[model samples]
Target: MIVSSFFPGRIRLRNEVFKDAEIYAALYAAVGNHPAVKKIERNERTGSVLLEYIPEKLPINKLLALQSDLLALGKLAEFYSAKNKPEILKKIKEIESKL
Candidate 1:
């Protein structure tokens, strides 16, 4: 994730994973529901997310970490699904090929 822009109470971030709408939506939902956040917007086309929040209530890093963890947990869940075992191997090979 890259902090495209940031100031006092607002921040914009861009991540390649966010180009996948489903992943972006998941993060959007998770962060948008937070009490400290006033607004959240995402543009999947550009993989950009903007957040308006109460800086006093929660540090921005914690919000970013929360989104990252949620995304990881969601992906990890897919790996453990019995129906996805075959898919897990396929994905592993895909990663190995990159290495």
Candidate 2:
């Protein structure tokens, strides 16, 4: 058995994840105090927004799709900026390799 001291880890939020989170948070915030959506708590300890009330049965397929769309936005932003085009292409290639 593989024994380790590591507790369950959280999914690391890359820029793409943060972008998606920001979009989702903004959308939910606009609907403010809705039964299906709520502002994540601002945690003083980590200075991060904590989403603590997601229903256990909520499916994450849509969330994953949103994240993919946000990653595309990041690539688009890189393309429009002065950054190298190859870099964005390389990143997208890497993502494609994973799929």
Candidate 3:
């Protein structure tokens, strides 16, 4: 995943492809509700996520960590199988707890 500052209050995440639309949908469901996030725009063609957020409400460090964790989850999804579903879900829960 590639993460960079896009604007004063925006961040761009690039190259985040998943195995399929289902995994992509799951990723959004997991991270789209961050309290500090003002808006989220996903580019399906390029597998990128653009985030606009309130710095005061959510520190940059926290946002970065959250995005990093989400990216990791997405990568894991690429190799998802019935045997690993439970482990993946547990990890997702762990990441969510931090948020």
The prediction achieving the highest TM-score against the true structure is 3
Q: Which lDDT tens digits does candidate 2 get at residues 61-85?
A: 5346446644664665334433544
Instruction: For residues 12-98, write the lDDT of model 1, one tens digit per residue.
Output: 877655565555555555566667789988887887788898887777566565564434443644445446544433443433232
Leading candidate by lDDT: 3
lDDT of 3 by residue, 3-84 (tens): 6546557877665353246545655666678777788778887767787878888776775777766677657656677666
How good is model 3 by TM-score?
Answer: 0.61
- Which ranges in model 3 have alpha carbons more than 4 Å from their true place? 4-8, 16-19, 64-93
Instruction: Sort every candidate by lDDT, greatest first.
Output: 3, 1, 2
User: Which prediction has more favorable TM-score, 1 or 2?
Assistant: 1
RMSD (Å) per prediction: 10.1, 10.5, 3.8
TM-score of 2: 0.32
Candidate 3 lDDT for residue 8: 56
lDDT of each: 0.61, 0.38, 0.67
Residue 66 C-alpha lDDT in model 3: 70
lDDT of 1 at 32: 68
Clashes of 2: 0
